[model samples]
Target: MTERHHILSDNAAALSDDAYDSDGFLIEEDGDDTSRPRLYDGDQLEREERAALRRVAGLSTELEDVTEVEYRQLRLERVVLASVWSEGTLEDAENSLRELAALAETAGALVLEGVVQRRQKPDTATYLGKGKAEELRDIVIAEGADTVICDTELAPSQRRALEDVVKVKVIDRTALILDIFAQHAKSREGKAQVELAQLQYLLPRLRGWGESMSRQAGGQAAGGQGMGSRGPGETKIELDRRRINSRIAKLRRDISGMKTHRETKRGSRRANAIPSVAIAGYTNAGKSSLLNRLTGAGVLVQNQLFATLDPTVRRSETPEGREFTLADTVGFVRQLPHQLVEAFRSTLEEVADSDLLLHVVDGSHPDPEGQISAVRAVLADVDAADVKEVIVVNKADIADPEVLDRIRRHEKHSIAVSARTGEGIEELRQLIAEELPQPDIDVDVLVPYDRGDLVSRLHEEGEVLASEHVGNGTRVTAKVNADLAAELAAYRA
Candidate 1:
């Protein structure tokens, strides 16, 4: 059982100098929890922390002795999930479980079984009432599941309580989602964002890694430290907390620099007078395939959800010869972790700034409409609701006819296509070309035959409504963006 997400999310107590909130309102950590011991309030900290932290902060840590460990990758854990619904209907609870299953699958975990408990209120200390938690433990034991994933984000105490009772490692929805993100991240930028998010989430949970050792109230050095010793040497949990905070600060600054660079690049695109179309949809919806199909971009396309987490921008010419930029960004999901959205805020701006949006849907999904709702929910959250959108029902070749009809009936601006077979691709392309804003100016111009490359460019980058031949020169009437018009100004005769 969990608190209403909308109401609980705004609490400042939900955030810290180190960790931040992801979807499901769970805290994700990035670094050790016991670095700084100076920032705790009231009972969260113990005495004799500052002296411990100051001493440890002066200690030097070494990395030169590090050795690479080759790993036969750990076998992915197959999991069973449990959820308790307090205030919502059965439908809400089921939908939440389905999403959790998806998150588990995304993290490469096979969902062996699932259970949902209903109650008017959740037990404050244990989440599910005692009887239900015990029952869930039996289910996990029967299924021989490798792990237990909870639908709700669990507090440190709650996580421990449940794990102790369940007799297995327990991770809530937020951590499971983070694990998926950690695996899907592929770009330099993508990796950094995921690492920063993971570290931030890992901070607070550092309080007691199953050891009764009181975290040094000193912050980062909460474990223990001599006058200048790092590690768990006499530092309190507060010391670990401060170290994470400092690392978070550096990551924020780095991400900010990346944001500025993106802004500069965006400015350049605007100056070039090119329209932009950003492809957005739920994960695994064929966005990458569509981009490669439309523009020959050759982006690494994988079948997994969130496979295309980093944004890829490519230049493409519409059939009418107009050039525009098409960007592929991370997919939206039901309850997409807010921390990811916040951390990737600059990237989502790629969607917000685009001239048009292509909302791709996997027509084959069992709940296409639900997927649509999930995507729109995140879009609204990211401030992209006002952007013009065209729904593209992709993977139609394998979709159920009844579902397809239902989708088409409800979608006024939707089209169906299979990116793989090239089915309906031409119609989709024409629809895209016609949907863009029409340029206002139409002019006739003449250019010497030797400037044929310019002439070719005109054909590739404009709507050539008419043309005439005149003694080694071509006179043409075309509709084009203003920048191109200016470039052709001298050729007008």
Candidate 2:
């Protein structure tokens, strides 16, 4: 306990029987050049991480009887991942373990070890069985870990009781996910959403900042402040919660204003009677790449999750020379946080107002069908499932033929294409032109040449079956959508 206390902070050194550096600074690592290929080991670190470990070996207390895991997990807060396989089979347990590993990685936590208990249902007080929870605490102590990452969201009371017993930080799946988002989000809107989720998570986790609250920041409180109070107006954790909430509100307002801007733009397109097509899919499914292929949009192409948060709208002409708006939306993810779905609702509403949905899938992914299911879940959450969709089996170049065949066989509205190689793009464009709603009738008339605006509008916004020119007037024939057909009623061309 004295060693554990020192490892955490200064005031608690007498609990465990080991020595520590008491140095406050963390050894820095280079984050530049994000293009390096990641080498993940289930156990043991890569050479670089091993070198770093050697450097810090003498700086921190060493524990005996620890096993190394395969992953470039270094300088990570050690954590125990616990899960209850309720209604979960062996496969489910393995999958839960894998996902927990990913979550722990994402949260900058090293997986010291993992444990799964089977139960018909979760225990009310201790997510795992009461005895098992005690065993887990012992595991944490043996591994010298100070945190536990649970596989499910724990109720408030359950969280408190478990932390009290475990005497370690315990964060659930949702909270861990939120923390990763907090770390990954770069854009203003993304930050706002992440902070909102974090604050909401903290609001419940704030019962007490756990044992750390008992220690003062630098030394004893100079005045009459309580142990948790430190020397500030509010404790560090409380101030963090308050700051997050304030930032969340500010972000909500900003997102609202941005939403209005989107509405205004939508209204402009609506008034002009120009139809829109929105591209959406699971993260890393090549939505951005498809947008670039379809419209030469020049959207950033990255091989990472949640890379593009800002919506990019570009114009493209169909094979029939008909122009329409193509919009690229943020990618969806498995178990996407509700706060994000809510925060980006306006951006996603672009899908709701679309003329059609280009639902792209990475036919190459091992679980393309599972990705589809995850995406559909999010779409249903936002009430956009009924939108007309064209299934685009993207990444055909690297995808297995069997995988492509499986999707084609299982889904009705599917097309296989390599967005990078331009394979099947022309057919896709022509198909898009055909799937678009047609005008009720083709209007034929001659108009004054001075109304070039009307002539161009007819050409761009409507399908022109024919067009000719006469003295001081232009003769034209075209088919237009219902809305544009109405707006062009006076033009009659």
Among the numbered candidates, top TM-score falls to 1
For all candidates in order, the CA lDDT equals 0.74, 0.71
Instruction: Compute each candidate's TM-score over C-alphas.
Output: 0.75, 0.72
Error of 1 at 155 (Å): 3.5
Q: Write the per-residue lDDT of candidate 1 for residues 280-348, one digit (tens) a residue.
A: 998889999999999999988887777778899999877766788999989887767777878888889
Best by lDDT: 1
lDDT of 2: 0.71
lDDT of 1: 0.74
- Quote the positional error of residue 128 for candidate 2 in Å: 2.4
lDDT of 2 at 365: 72
